[model samples]
Target: MSEKQEPSIWQGFKAFLMRGNVVDLAVAVVIGAAFTNIVNAVVKGIINPLVGAVGTQNLDHYSSCLSSSCEGDQGIQLMWGSVLGATLSFVITAAVVYFLMVLPMAKYLARLEARRKDQEKGTEATPEVIEVTELEVLKEIRNALVAQRGSGHDER
Candidate 1:
């Protein structure tokens, strides 16, 4: 009696790591980290300066005290400016990724899918092709049966 053995843990791990999605995810994470630097630079260099025209250039410094007669580090300070700066950075990053990467890739994939469909349609068998194939199959079956019967008669 033979027993079937399950795959080892190492083999399963290797297979998981070798999947296309895992590699793609790793690449995306690396690229995203690199892209984040560019987005942060844009926000600090351009957006902060523009905002500085109205107030201070440093968003971290902008805050509001919620309590009256509050001394150093003794009040409810709402750092809305920093939140705004972070939000702007996120929005810029999203826009850049969508327009530059995601949108173009989607369009390219759509074009490829369309082309594939067109090729499939072009290669599809017509009624005449089907008829000819059926006829050939029938002829082969008839010849096979005839040969089988002739061999049986000889054996007898």
Candidate 2:
């Protein structure tokens, strides 16, 4: 008997690399990293300036003293502006990614799924159903019994 040969490590690695999902994920990761730079620039240039209208341009500088007096490093400080800026950036990035990529892709996939379902439904054959009355059923049973007797199977 011939034995089946298992695939080598290189063959498995090649298959993994050649997969569509892996390639797509790599492209997405690269694009996402580039997009992050643009988002960071926008936050730093435009959004930070807008935030500056309320306080300092650098949000890290906008801190409040927790103690009675803010003497050197003696008092505790709450950096609310930095937190606010970070939150704004996160919201902006999420909104842009959703509107530009995720939302549209989801909508397109939904449309494709709906079309596939419609095609499947259209191609399928409807089953034929015959409604047999109780009288017909009884007649069929009688005929079957007669046929069985005609078969000449005598069990003496």
Candidate 3:
């Protein structure tokens, strides 16, 4: 048999776009963007200062460009302190979710499943069925014929 033809670029692109995974990813992206502002605010509000006390530095005011020309080909320099603050906030959020949501949810689901299994296991098992063999049936038929002959049942 001949190999199937490949889908065209447009067809493939459409298929990719139409898949549920892609749609879910798109929705997650939108939600993430909306949530980012709140997360950033919390970091800026609380975590940065806490870190600042330990390092004797602040995350709020962290970047300064060193290029002599203010606008030549230089992009915005990276601010490590702000990055650190963001990272710290992310860690905190991750920890909270793990402890408060994911861990507890997992444990609860596991316990529920275990309980269901236990209930099922406690019930009695079904009885085994026996299958008769052709030889056994033939033996019984022969015995019945012998007994009928002994009882004088020769109607034929």
- Model number with the top TM-score: 1
Model 2 stretches astray by more than 4 angstroms:
1-28, 37-58, 71-74, 120-156
Worst-scoring 10-residue span by lDDT in model 1: 125-134
Q: Give each model a TM-score.
A: 0.50, 0.44, 0.42
Best by lDDT: 2
CA deviation > 4 Å runs, candidate 1: 1-24, 37-58, 123-156
RMSD of each: 18.1, 22.1, 23.4
Better of 2 and 3 by TM-score: 2
**TM-score of candidate 3 against the unseen true structure:** 0.42
What global local distance difference test value does model 1 have?
0.67
- Tens-place lDDT digits, model 2, residues 68-145: 988787888898879976777688667766666656655554455456556888863333333444465546555655
Candidate 1 C-alpha lDDT tens digits along 44-134: 6776677679876557767888988457888788898899867766786677666666566555544554555568888632222111233
